[model samples]
Target: MLASKSIKMSKEQVSTFPNADELLDRMRKMSEDESLWKKSKTDSGVDIFEGKVSTKYRQFRGVGYVDQPLATMVSVVKDAEKRKQWNEQMMGNEVVEDISEHVKVIHSKFNGGAASNRDFCVFYTDHLSDTEYIDAQTSIIHEKCPVMKGFVRATCLISGTRMIAESPTRTKVFYLGQVDLGGMVPSFVANIVNMKQPLCIARMRDFAMKDAASSSSVPSSASTSPQEEKQNEEK
Candidate 1:
């Protein structure tokens, strides 16, 4: 018997194939090439994010996919442009101009909760930028905003799960397919994806539950995420 730890586990069992080997073969045939997602490549570059986004039908399920909407993604590109303008004006430097130019538009029609707006914003700079980063790090509380000092975050956020982690290119779930995440997935996958250790299924359930809570299909705030909003709220 399987472990009884699963939530809402069904008594009905699933026994496909004659034996273990057959099941393995079936799974193997259905599985995608591991290498396909191994490269940890960025989607379009700037739209390196994929989370839950609303569609014509409002979803209460938290199972949103990342990086799959053209119009929404293009908006993100435009938002990056605005932020770039702001950051450049602040820095008086040509840094952060071309940071998120390749944001892709992943289509998220049936993921349920929201389409995963997945993409990456890699800021691999040279010595000057690195030095400025160190300066900001040293200042800590004194520093205004990290981006103000020429740092671009490579972070991921699930529409429902919230922020996954930072700097870890490609999501682990990007390996296998992700879950439906119910309706309320917590809307924070990007922050959550970068976590060193993976969260148990129970935790994922919680994220999905949160997504179910905020069933409003209304789009979230502008390019700035809920995290950014909270940070601004605190400030």
Candidate 2:
């Protein structure tokens, strides 16, 4: 449990959390080592795997394909507000500090039904390239955010999504999460929840599909009249 304090740190101070490159290296190693994980089940098109780690909570990974470009999928993951709309468990998410254009300190709250609510303060970062996109986050102790009265402070050991561009319209997605939801949560209950965690990838894929559909439905700039384009640009 974290002490109740309202201390704020400078951006330089918060930036000391682990960077994206190091975390990406770890993610690659974990994902590539098949011996460390066992196939759990497949939901929709996503295949879920469960593995043991240093924490009491098991680490789960989901592998699947989404019918959206890497860039579009990246946009969907990066949009924090949009995430809350699809993730029913997410109660709140906000940026606590900006470490860089790609790295940030994020504070997120979750609704733990039948148990106390949970929250986490983590360092979030992402890397995008022509071939692959990686977004990762890990627990971080920030003075600005502490365990509130009604919530338990949870630790996000390591979690994120990795997307590999398969084609202009398709991407291979990998989602991993290892979190310690600190409290008296029973092992059986935790295991059940962890098993379903991978379903989130399917939800994400559906969300991205809808977003792509909506974007495609909008009129392109080329279809707009010169006057309308000028007015849109002016606005």
Candidate 3:
């Protein structure tokens, strides 16, 4: 069985991040391979694939569904300041530069459990295409933000999110990322990446769904600005 599995997976699919369609296609093939290996080892709702992008770097592709509107999901994802609320390992996250309506540079630091904390300064630009799908990607070169001490800056070679509306109120999110976390990675760190990536998707879904529910429950008269909502939550 193992031999047959290996033979089956040898059929190559494009691993490079040339475009969104190619990325999505690669993810589909990865999902199939992962399913064949061991279903029990993977997350229930997320399809995860790992590959080597370079000698010391790895690429990850994750696809998951969120039961929330595309707009709601995108809004939550684009709000970098609020990410720590749901993202498990985000110790610090901030928008370093807002270049335009759809372009900005974000700095984020992550705790690696026992390992040294890792950080990345990324220039991100997001836009809704003609097909109504939201595309967001982090620039490979982000010199606007300074790297912090004690946190090794990661190289986000290719990292982005693609959101497509599967239904009026449901969105299919696809994530593709290739990062080089500086220094040697322990087994625990790799395991954390495998587990935490799926959990991140679950967290985003929960956050967006909860927000949608709360928004729907509020009376139109009580509708308030985001600042008002935040103040109320704090109070």
Indicate which candidate wins on lDDT. Answer: 2
The best candidate by TM-score is 2
lDDT of 2 by residue, 53-114 (tens): 53456889989999888888887777777888668789988888888898888899999877
Better of 1 and 3 by TM-score: 3
Separately for all candidates shown, the number of backbone clashes (residues 3 or more apart, or on different chains) is 75, 0, 0
Clashing pairs in 2: none
lDDT (CA) per prediction = 0.25, 0.80, 0.60
The stretch of ten residues in a row with the least summed lDDT in candidate 1 is 133-142
- What is candidate 1's lDDT per residue for 1-235, written digit by digit as tens? 1111133324243111123233233233222233222232233221122223333222111111222222222222224343233222222222222323321122111111233322122121111121111000000111112322222222211111112212222121211122222223443442343221122222333333343355456566566887888999999
Error of 3 at 180 (Å): 1.7
Q: Which tens-of-lDDT digit does each residue in 1-235 have in candidate 3? A: 0111112323232111134344444444443344333222346577665653233345566668998778777777777665777776888767776667765667878997788898876655556752344444432333355567787766555566667788877888766555556556643554446434544666788888887788888878767989998999999
lDDT of 2: 0.80
Off by over 4 Å in 3: 1-42, 52-55, 95-98, 130-144, 186-195, 219-235
Off by over 4 Å in 2: 1-16, 52-55, 218-235
Could you tell me the lDDT of residue 58 within candidate 2? 81
**Higher-scoring candidate on TM-score, 1 or 2:** 2
